[model samples]
Target: MRKLILLITLTLSGTLAVGQTTQKPPLHGKHWMAITGKPLAATAGSMIFNKGGNAVDAACGILAANCTMWDVLSWGGETQALIYNPKTKKVIAINAMGVAPTGATPEFFKEKDMAYPPEFGPLAATTPGTPGGLMTMLAEYGTLSLAEVLAPAMEMAKGYPIEAQTATIIENQKHLIKEWPYSKKVFLPHLGEEREAPYPGEVFVQEDLFQTLKKLVDAEKEALAQGKNRKEAIYAAYARFYTGDIAEEIVRGTREQGGLFTMEDLAKWKVKIEEPLQVNYRGIDVYKLQEWTQGPAMLQSLNILENFDLKSMGYNSANYIHTVYQAMNLAFADRDFYYGDPAFEPKSPMKGLLSKEYARERAKLIKPINDPEIGPGDPYPFQGEKNPFLHLLEKQNEVIAYNNHGTAILGPDDPFLESFLAGTTSIQTADAEGWVVSVTPSGGWVPATIAGNTGVGLSQRMQSFVLDEKLNPFNVLEPGKRPRVTLTPSMALKDGKPYFSFAVQAGDTQDQNLLQMFLNVVEFDMTVQEAAEAANFNSYQMQSSFGAHESKPGAITLNTQIPSWIRGDLKKRGYKMDFLERTSGPLNAIWFDWKHGTFWGGSSNHGEDYGIAW
Candidate 1:
């Protein structure tokens, strides 16, 4: 280790990374840019933009289309987004995350002999959030009608070529799909055959889902015929989904599937548009959705990271990785314990958690070695208030560990790790009119239980809740309380102008990969595409927000391309090193070349993510 440090000292060039050449060419656009988790989805956004819609409208199009294609998500999931409305000249956050339905208390799960909520099934669902989210964004900020934005998705629902990835997932999880009658009907078109699921490139048709969408469009058309304006017409459609026959079907279908969703749960749950949380790092303002979605953890990391000279350590160096890893663990420790829906009592110590002085205190705790004992710190004291859960908080730290989440020999398919990196998709859109949007929408992937004939997939986000206050006092499951989620969308502004918009699809690793990608651009001079393809590392030391909520302290994962000596050095520092061929994101991003007055889009080369700029 000493020899490696001396080597790093002597060969700073080796430690510091240089600019990287990328496999895919950078995307350049002037009129608009659309990038997402799928090619057809990006085209959906482009189509809306071509129809003279702004970024928010195009983003809704991309989001709805991805759900229709089951790009690891569906309409009955959740949507968390940060939009930079040029009209307001400020970033706005949409809280479309669903809450637990009635009778979904901690005691209910404990009585079932479960540690947490089930990962799949109707019992796992929260009230649907995506449809309300899409309509809210379109109605409030977008110029186009709901029918206009949903056209592409409705078309795909009628019949679109199913991709290999989604089709294989259906085939692999056929048994689970068969359990849900509606899902069995929609997903197993060739049931009892050798291949139960649809084939890749096969024209898959979702008549029920198509009908569901048509009903919403029909509602809009009826409202317009009655002389309602565009926004009012959109809300009329929204009301029909949440309060009319659609909500009735959702409730009836969910109840029949052994789920719990009431008309009240669907109607009472409304989309919230609020100012997002922000923290400035070196004069650049980074914005994210609030604590409800684990977004503030990234802001906290940036606060602590502001105290370090990451550029001097070289990108992804042992020192850099360890520092960032420790910082993420620190922020996530707080996330596990304090982050929950702020609407409830005993709110998170946002005033203290994001405090620069508190960050300095947390930063001071980082040692040369990984600290397995590192856990949640007292942000309440920093904020000058008595902690409401101080007694529980002490025990919470000790309990924030797992005996075995992932083994050194375990494959990526290990249940814990796979769940840790599970579902969702991201959408990024920008227009010449100055509208910008970033969205991370997730839940209800394949093998999902379709709620009745509503053709909506139920969200499995209820698993994100804790059954014990000792685990997370704020996030303990309760009726009508939103679960603390891992989905986060990110954006940054520099000199009061949109700098970049970025987000990814994953569970616990969403912010981890996003933090590294942001640093790849801000700290290193990597272009957006280079950053997207860069070899990144992961620290499994923090408590995961997905299934099992496991934590494996001192565990670090890296790409095979990392230098052997750096890997050895990290191992010497007590990191249980895991290697993979690709560890970075499927990160999707857009960099604004403010001086040139254009957009530079980066779609990750690691996944099926694609982008178009024109």
Candidate 2:
């Protein structure tokens, strides 16, 4: 409904001479932008854009560079992306997430004397989806070849100076790295020398990783030389990783290490391009990856919040935070209960969960004070069926005792409990021609063993799956079933035109942080930078989507900048509040103002995030 106005008014009087006047209008230009949680990745994407490539090309480059940030991203991890093409006026979602091995089963883990798959070994690894995902994007929507975009990342793998955060992460995981020979060989110092973590200025190199990437580039070259077109060459590169020697090495190493990945699994895995799930918030259309990820949680929360006047509630106020927390809790409740890979579902539940009427009905259950246990809604009523998980949902109300491995004691003193949170990196790119992309590439984090000498590590994503046999229909272990990943990227359009692209890199806190940033822009009318910098809070009132699926009812953590009075008000309203030195997640955003012909971008300054506009 808001439109940019451009006009000049002039008045003439009964004088001998006439004067003309004009009003200054907002300046506009074609904008090229890129933002990421790391400076090098942002620079890499900008380089691609500067070289006359579109957003898809820049996105490929950015994702490749992100692999170097081993502290926050994984070289052999999974990726999910949303790309908007101005040419076709269509938005596409890429589900490049990893899947469970055919041999993975609860019975297998139980037989091995484990309650669940070990989180740091070969048994925890899944078939990586990044290579296929990136190549598919290049083949379909990208302007440059894979080798061209990946050149910067290959150089980074050859050698680069370590950063402070990465240094700290490596130091913390040193003990775990020592557990695996290949991991120690690649990440730790030599066995006989004084084992020390790489310092901030110290050069860190991964020659093996460099060679692995070069192999893919060589495959592309070979294809090109064989008279194949660019798309075919890209596929050749993908095959090199998924169906060639790389796949063979992964399968062999996984089997040797007592894992279950097979050549057939690798051959069958491919990135799927599907339509993004969307919801209308105000006049804007927000898009996210489907239920396989936690992306729809943001949309569901928005749909619930759309019932209230967020602007009147005031930003970050007790009422505002409480309202958002309540909505988020409800949405997450549904996320935990119903979200899964649609390929495995008997029927799609998204149509019911995304229905505005369903959101309104769910929102009516929100209380001024946090509900002790707000379970998933009966979305199936809209689908004309009884809720299938009603019994399990009711059972979740009873808190289960957690067996802390390191500390038997409960409370803040438990070392195992305190070390639960983690972070990731996000990248967003948009070219002047209006091709936009938002990607969250993650997995293969530390404590996980590298796949033999291939330089590619396996993702521990299988840990996100529920081991309970009763929950098998949703989020349970199954061959080729995608994990219910917390990685979510977002895009929005105003008046059916591309408006902004955004994503954050925190586990369960991702959608929470994204919702806050988005509302800051649409409701509080903050600039992209101001919105990203604003104080934020995360609610842990529902079960986490990670290991053990812990839930802390009525728990909320806010940035220290939030006023004490607001914190006290929330406490008075029956909420437990905690404060962190800074916000939980690192966020990145790129906004395009079509009417003004301008692009604006922002990245969190709290971490190594960088935003570049040209």
- Cα RMSD (angstroms) for every candidate in the order listed: 6.3, 8.4
- Write the residue-wise lDDT of candidate 2 on 395-446 in tens digits: 5544322211122222444332343355667888887788889998888877
The top-ranked prediction according to TM-score is 1
Q: lDDT tens digits, residues 1-614, model 1?
A: 99777766855654433233676778999999999999999999999999999999999999999999999999999998999988879999999999999999878889999999998999999999999999999999999998899999999999999999999999999989999999999999999999999999999999999999999999999999999999999999999999999999999999998998999999899999988999999999999988888999999999999999999999989999999999998998899888998999768889999999999999998899888768888988788998888898778755854444345344567676787778588999999999999999998998798999988998999999999888888888889999999999999999999998999877888899999999999999899988988898877767777777777777777899999999888988888877888888789999999889999999877789999889
Residue runs of model 2 more than 4 Å from their true location after superposition: 1-29, 346-348, 399-420, 469-472
Scored by lDDT, model 2 comes in at 0.79
- Number of backbone collisions per candidate: 0, 0
TM-score of 2: 0.91
TM-score of every candidate relative to the true structure: 0.96, 0.91
Give all candidates' CA lDDT scores: 0.90, 0.79
| Residue 289 local lDDT, model 2 | 97
Highest lDDT among the candidates is held by which one?
1
